[model samples]
Target: MSMSRTWPVWARTMVSRGIYSRPRTSQERLRRAVEGKTVLITGASQGIGRATASRLAAAGAQVVLTARNESNLRELEEEIRAAGGEAAAYPVDLSQPELIDEMVDKVLAKHAKVDILVNNAGHSIRRSIDLCYDRYHDFHRMTAVNYLGPVKLTLRLLPVMRAAGAGKIVNVSTFAIRTPPFPRWGGYHASKAAFDVWLRAIGPEIRADGVRICSVYMGMVDTAMTAHTPSLHRLPTLTVADAAGIVCDGAAGNRRALGPWWCAPLEAGSVFVGRPLDAVFSRLYQRSSDTDAARRAIL
Candidate 1:
């Protein structure tokens, strides 16, 4: 499939360079797309969400930032305002179903319509099934934040988007959903996979209505969240700004899906060599766990 046919060459180039290059050229085109538009970003308190909010606001967009951290959100909003950018801070916990409804109401009331929606808020838990056998709450909490929250929010905002005749929905996803499942990521992967499938299934139906859906399968990003995993530090990771830039580019370009170039090849390999790949990962994980256990015993 030719990506160029689906998205403009500039859009694809912008996304690719945002990931691979570091020149930080002026994204004036993206800024024009964002200028005077209203964008709502979830998880805007810190990390990628905060970074994305800053990027869009700098481009002249009126940014609505939402997160559980009221103080941080205020700080960010003030910073943007001080820089001559339009911004508003709304704090909401996505995990609460009732809060989702209230948030949608408040956002629509204030902006009248949301031109771009960035679903960047999500929770991830890492634990083996053996360790989670007695912890069913893991599935519940992860699903609430990672799956239910975004879906409900999108559904609520759809009527407004349709009435306006154009909208962009950018889902922030992880590459793990495309690769073979990992051993200790059951809850996290399952929730992410659910949303990925749901978005793909509904994408076509909404496209004709001038609603563009872009799914971004990103790789490991260097953030406070990933800092907890020491093993991830050894691997190459994109900075928060880079990750946010890729997302901002996708939203501005209206691409179908924005992912690393290798995402398709990896997905194909997983489909054709499922069992073999699974076997390889199983052995690798077993060896790593054994080494870790031994080191812990010595300590």
Candidate 2:
């Protein structure tokens, strides 16, 4: 069967256009997209994960927030409750892949079905490969959290999502991947990139089952993760809350695709419109890097 290229591309463009427009008043955009639904968000103790959890709960989602730090997750739960939002805290170590089965069982036992699974948990260390050396476990550790952890968790949820017959999977990806040899991000980039490819490939096969996967390729968003990067690379960054809003918008829209506008220029000439904008981003990134290095050496 011949496919309709325009629908998906147009859908993505329209979604991005809407997410950028008059911008829904927080309350308006948020509404009951969450009502009667349950959501699980990882890395929810802080940053983008926290931002997503707070909004989903406020929008009436019975949100399950998870992170490695139980105390911190509890504190966030209190904050969400104080704001009159529904939330529950779960503490789990994503580094331990074996635990996903148990975690999924626990969430199902309590919530019945997780309507939205935001694979937002991840780790990033701003160090070059040289700094990592024989500490190869560091690579596995980061990949475990930023990639495999989410992939495994997502797979575990598939049965529930398929049974429920409608669901959304949001994978947070980086604009940094546009540039290869992303400065000092060897582990984080490679890991996230691998997961991103895997998610995008399988995302379509399951769409007929009413399971939608939206991969959010974001430019830098200000958070503790970006704390040490030179301000130049981080200046245009969105606040964590702002970034989360964009992500939720995609999930709420239930659209097949959502991503940055820059991808448009880069994607227009692709042999296939849905092909990622990796090539363009890589060249632009190289130029940006040279400019940055030159600026820093003289200062």
TM-scores, all candidates, are 0.88, 0.79
Model 1: lowest-lDDT 10 consecutive positions: 290-299
Which regions in candidate 2 have their CA more than 4 angstroms from the true location? Answer: 1-26, 179-181, 231-234, 267-299
lDDT of each: 0.81, 0.73
lDDT (Cα, tens digit) per residue for candidate 1, span 76-124: 9999999999999989998887998998889889899999999999877
Native-to-model Cα distance after best TM-score fit, residue 154 in candidate 1, in Å: 0.4
Clashing pairs for model 1 are: none
Clashes of each: 0, 0
Candidate 2, residue 19: Cα displacement in angstroms equals 14
How do the residues 1-299 of candidate 2 rate in per-residue lDDT, one tens digit apiece? 11212235455344434433212336555675667688899999889999888888888888999889899899989998999888888788988877777787888899889988888888876554444575687788888998888888988998789888889898888765644344556778989888888988988888888888887776566576765455333234455666788778766876554555555555444445423445665565556433333224221
Best by TM-score: 1
Candidate 2 structure lDDT: 0.73
TM-score of 1: 0.88
Clashing pairs in 2: none
The per-residue C-alpha lDDT of model 2 at residue 67 equals 88
